[model samples]
Target: MRQNPERRTALTDAAIEVLAEQGARGLTFRAVDQRAGVPTGTASNYFPNRDALLTQAGRRVFERLDPGPEAVGEALALPRTRASVDRLMHEMVDRITAFPSGHLAMLELRLESTRRPELRAVLTEQIRANLQENIDFHLASGLPGDAETVVHLYLALSWLIVERLTLPDLFDADRTADLITTLVARLIP
Candidate 1:
């Protein structure tokens, strides 16, 4: 594998784009190199095989989707109310949608993981950790929700995101935002 961290990240990111656009079958080293605009075989240097590339791409999508400290701080600052939860959910939707490729690649990875047990394990671990983090944040933030509430919100909002990303025309922007508010109101106490 190559020792250049930046190049490796770039290749992984490119792989994400390839996965998003072409699905797992279309993800090839040459395609990744072209997407990254690097010389041919560059991705192969960084990833020994397709599975390694796919695994790294899965990790990279989460890294790219991380909302960072600023967003977390902003969430914590909000009042602990159902309306606040609504606002937080709206912000979450906006944040996830902003990186369309990352979310779309995540969907692809979820599908691919079904065929590859190793990939399935990696995604399962990462997703479970992320879910736990969300649950912990909701509890610690004093948000108007328990762990179950958080889990329901997570499931609902995730499907909403899938709808928004895969079939955006199904719901317009205002309608989608309205749906988030409704979800928070109904799910939170």
Candidate 2:
């Protein structure tokens, strides 16, 4: 099929929506096509196989969810104080929790990775790169944590936010920001 960025983007988004709503099992070309409101073979024409679609869908989720370099630069430009860390933490949590659908799509990516080694390798590499970027951001911002501590704490906080935002039954939403604030206070100070 001819390469069309807009069409490909729509298809990838459709894949994420299907994956988020129905999980890996139901993430088929037909499902994406149906979700995208496109022709039956449209998704397959864009993505030759399941792995390609899954990989692109995973990438799309992160691309949509991550705060990116500009935001990181702005955060790092803030004064190197505990308050900066708190602000950054709040911003990160807010970005992740602001959209439950994005987190849901990411969860689908992680689960799909568990079932597919090919997908796992791709996800693992991307995850490592993202963590490194986050660590680099925090270190540059003078957050009082090494890469290991920063990443671990961030992951814990993120998991809490995701759980609270998407699966409120699993975790209390009322305490999430407080939990994040406390974690940031301890980790940064």
Error of 2 at 31 (Å): 1.2
Give me the runs in candidate 2 sitting further than 4 Å from their true place: 169-173
lDDT of each: 0.93, 0.81
Cα displacement (angstroms), candidate 2, residue 133, comes to 0.7
lDDT of 1 at 57: 93
Question: Worst ten-residue run, lDDT, model 2?
Answer: 165-174
Model 2 residue 92 lDDT score: 75
Cα lDDT tens digits for candidate 1, 1-189: 788999999999999999889988999999999999999999999998999999999999889889899999998999989988998889889989999999999899999999999999999999999999999999998988899998999899999999999999999899999999888888888
Per-residue lDDT of model 2, residues 29-112, tens digit only: 999999999989998888889999999988887888878779867976888887777777778777877766667877888887
Winning candidate number (TM-score): 1
